[model samples]
Target: MPIIDTHCHLDNIQYQDDVDTVIQTALNEGIEAILIPGADPKDLPRAKMLAEKYPEVYFAAGVHPYDCENYDLDILKTYITHPKCIAVGECGLDYFRLPEDEIEKAENIALQKKIFIDQINFAKDVKKPLIVHIRDASDDSKTILMQHNAKEVGGVLHCFNASEHLLPLSEHNFYFSVGGVITFKNAKKLVDILPKIPLNKLIVETDGPYLTPHPFRGTRNEPKYTNNVVTKISEILSMSKSEVSKLTTENAKKLFKEFDIKN
Candidate 1:
């Protein structure tokens, strides 16, 4: 039952009061490791601290699309050098919440693309894998990734939205990270696409503090809940739970290439 939550936000305020307990519970449940993504510059320190405090914890250094407005490459570069920083993102295009004003929306899209491209280049420069986050901007995201030759360093599309258009990325060294959303009733699209994703490129995430799996949707998400994700994936792929766990854990290690699973 060894598992790795490749994208939980342990730095989120939701876990401020009891992150230790949450992490220990995850460990007790057989989640071997957790990677906190850097969505906010303010949280990178906290993420780093947690990674230092717990051997099972690691983190990525990059801003989310929603937080691109505050993007600062120099600031992110500092965290990129940390020994515990495993990847370069959670960064990419997100068009789900563009402004109503056409002009403002256009400007916003441009900024996100700029930030996204900058981060991609930065990842390449640092020679680290990326943890991409693409939403309604799939077309743009795929185009940018291809145009920029992101395959050089490789990466994972965190919370992969099941857009068939992005499937070709598999050939370019990209992996797809499925999260708790797969357990939802409306995840038919993702469920169907799951089998299509090359098993070698498949990994799992909780995306904790958000997208909590069923049987606990409204409650705050935590790394411990990755069990539900593994269960649903096993059912969807018709594989044993341990098989899913082993394969995904290996996929994560192959991509992140930072920490090793401790016995």
Candidate 2:
């Protein structure tokens, strides 16, 4: 079955020693495409370079919520025009880890919202979809997305961990992607909600070098682990792996139209 690991950080330092090997292994493992999402502003250049190096690889350009400090939108804009830069994010609100001080926390949240909104507008301007990252702030994220009329281009809720309350966003052109976290034994919440998510609105990913799936939770994740993600989703949905893979791959291509799956 063909697969697309829609959110991986191949340019991260963890894979610096053997990114070539990692890409080849992922390809050999039947991954048809891999998207490297930008987190820090400085990483976009390297992400762009990697996308250029591999025809099967693509990337997005944006600053992650945590990295929103002193973000330079100018740099992001410069790369957003790159043919290989398929989306505008990996950008959204993540209140999971915030400053301990009340004042700092409030300030941080505000900054996150600002940057997220800016990226949303950037996506609109470029006529590209977003790759949103929301955690511990799904309500706020949903509100902001709605307020900005982000559905004009649509996007995926990468590594989706929000409440079922936000599931209705499917009508607004929002899709979801699950990662190794779904394979965890204690991921009961996510597992229970798995089937609830419309299959066509779901895609599989491996947030590589992090969230390694069960039985390999301690090791750094790689794109090849995407197969494990597909298998688990199959088990949860009571469907064959191939069926899940094909549908998810199609869903991914549908969201990321730049993939050119015909090749």
Candidate 3:
């Protein structure tokens, strides 16, 4: 069985010249495929191009919450339904850095909710899954997702660090994407919480260009190092490396399919 990087930004500008090496590293690492998540409209075209270049790279198209604050989805919406755009997201709310003014929070939440609903319905209408990005706004994210009937077109909370108690959000139907952070000594809270998640509800990622795991910590991350994520998840679950690899690879194919992949 081969590993699958469930979430990574191989489309990031940092990889332009070195992409081939990065991808080759994935292949050599027994990584069978990757879901290159689009961070914003600016990255979607490059994401599609990279997916086309790599036989194993699939992609999604949508705006990240941080970047989506000033969005004009109409333009991106047209191209979002393209064949290579298998999902709509990396989109959601981020109240972590925002002020707690009720009015301000409400306004941002409203905007986030609108985009989330729009993207969910677009995903439902276009017939694709979603790739969600939620940070410090888990409550709002869950609330709006439920209100929009997000379960109709299921997705994942990519690069998640929420508590185990919040796993019920997946009950409404979503997978939890675990990344390299779970391996760190300082992430004991997350590590202690993650094993409680059932294997079927989990997916692995690098979220690269970030979250480099231990030993490799403090360095830039990439899809090639997604194995570090799997290795740690395997340790937490007390499962074999091959088990985690096979299960997550199947999990990835189940959520997002592509022509190049023999789904």
Candidate 4:
């Protein structure tokens, strides 16, 4: 069975020097499709360019929480409709790295919420699914997603952090993605919760150049490593690697309807 890397940042600087080689390597590894998520407005064009260069590649358009400070929703909207632009994020609340000062932290949270909500609306408007990135702000992320009726379009909780509280989101059209992190020896939290994730709602990703799996721990991550994630999921769920690959790829295609899966 073929695999789809549901989330990756091929546009990141780490892959700049040999992106083609990286992409070809994944393809050679049976990765049939690759989705490059939008993290910053500046990276949008590069992402789109890659999508154009590779028929099997797709991209999303939204500002990440870290870049929310100067985000202009209108500017991001321009690329959301592109045929290769498959989703609306890599966007959501991230309070994990906020300031220590109370006032600054509060301000950062408020800005993140505002930008995240706006992008949620944009996804609804464009009639596309989302590519959410939540970290240390599950409550607010859940509240805002619920309040905004984000369930209407659905999305993937990218690189899911194993918060079972968010499991209810499976019914709300939110799928969960497991990344290379699940392969870590200390990923007991995620491993414990892996089985709870609905089979149909589980997708696989690499979050490349970050969260590189065990053995490759300190090395630069790439899309080819997605197979390692699938292997780990197989071991955890007691399923064959091919089965995990097929189901996860189907789940991804189900969410990203724009991608007509030939497999």
Candidate 5:
């Protein structure tokens, strides 16, 4: 079963010096494709180049929430139209790194939300699925997206962190994606919810260069570890690892059909 990493940042500096080796390793482990998102302007070109150079790689172009101080939506829209770009995101609300001062907190979040909304609009215009990256702001993110009528070809809440409150987003055509965190010791809640979530609406990712699975939590994360995540999620859902990989790969392909990735 070939796994698809739906949210790995292969263009990041963490893998810049060894991209060829990192990608080769993922192939060695049966990781067939990856969605490499450009979180910052400086990394956008890299994301495109990597996707173009590698047949199995695709790009998601957007400016991340944390770095939304001075964003240019027009440029984002322009760059995202490149043939290699398949989605618009890795963008969403992030309260984890907000300023310590209480007064500035609201402003920071507001700015992030504004940027997120703009990107959502861009996604709608381009008709490409979105890739959300919510961090400690799920409720707000859901509220805003819902209010804006996000159902217009809704996307996935990638690398989901909580399982208690399933983000009833499918009504909006959205799906939830899981990653290495589900394989952690303290993820019993997620494990319990795994079997409950609709399989067709579920997708798996690695978010590589970060969130490495349990067995290699402290080690540098890479796409090759996507297998461990698939194994863990499959066990939680009482299915074979191959089954999980197959479904998730299909889900990823359906979401990013522009790439023509055959599962």
Candidate 6:
């Protein structure tokens, strides 16, 4: 079975010069499919274009918390209905870069929360799974997901942060997406938590243009690096690389039902 990179920012400027080559390289290397997440509304068009041009590419439509200030539901709705647009997000709370001023930080958090909740509801309304992005605000993200009854739509926690608090989400129809960060030496926390995640809830991502895996840590990331992530996961889970790839690809297809993998 081939691997699936469930979350990759192929629309980023980093791939502007040679995206076609990048996609072909990943396909040649056994990466069966790639998902382009919507971080900024400005990038959704580019994402959609890539998805339309490549049969193996699909996309999601939602704003990242950092771009919450520009969250416009109307604009997102335009892309959400695309045949290749399979999920609702890359959206959630990101408290990693809040303002230094207490008042500014509070306001920023409020805006992020509001936008996150709105997206969650939108996903439910559309009856599509979500591609959530949670950072340092795991508690808030978990609470919001539960309160909003996000289980109705389920989701993949893009780049799961090894937070024990989120493990129970597996029962709520949420899957944990492991990425290149798992190969980092300092990723002991995630390494330790790897086996704790239910195998069925496991999926893989590259989060390309960021979190490039080890031995290539300083370089740009691409979907082909999903192979590195699968290798690390197989080692941690005491399974073969093919086993890990099959399971993760199955989990991804389960969550993003629109994925039309022929093989």
C-alpha lDDT of all candidate models, in order = 0.92, 0.90, 0.78, 0.91, 0.83, 0.94
Query: After superposition on all CA atoms, how large is the RMSD of candidate 2?
Result: 1.1
Show the colliding residue pairs in model 2.
Answer: none
* Per-residue alpha-carbon lDDT of candidate 2 for residues 1-263, written as tens digits (9 for 90 to 100): 79999999998999999999999999999999999998997887788889988999999998888789857889988998999899998899999899999999999999999889999999999999999998888789899999999999999999557479779888889898999999998899999888889888999899998999988999999999999999999998899999989999999999999997545
The local lDDT score (0 to 100) that residue 9 gets in candidate 6 is: 97
State candidate 4's TM-score.
0.98
TM-score per candidate: 0.98, 0.98, 0.92, 0.98, 0.95, 0.99
What lDDT score goes with residue 17 in model 6? 100
Runs with alpha carbons beyond 4 Å of true place in candidate 4: 261-263
Task: State how far residue 171 of model 6 sits from its true place (Å).
Answer: 0.7
Candidate 4, residues 94-199, lDDT tens digits: the string is: 8889999999999988888888998999899989999999888888889899989999999999955688888999999999999999999899999999999999
**Residue-level lDDT tens digits of model 6 in 23-56:** 9999999999999999999999999999989999
- Number of clashing pairs, model 6? 0
Global CA lDDT computed for model 6: 0.94
Off by over 4 Å in 1: none
Span of 10 residues, lowest total lDDT, candidate 2: 159-168
Predict model 1's lDDT versus the native: 0.92
Best candidate (score: lDDT) = 6
C-alpha positional error of residue 156 in candidate 3 after TM-score superposition, expressed in Å? 0.6
Off by over 4 Å in 2: 261-263
Give the winner by lDDT: 3 or 5.
5
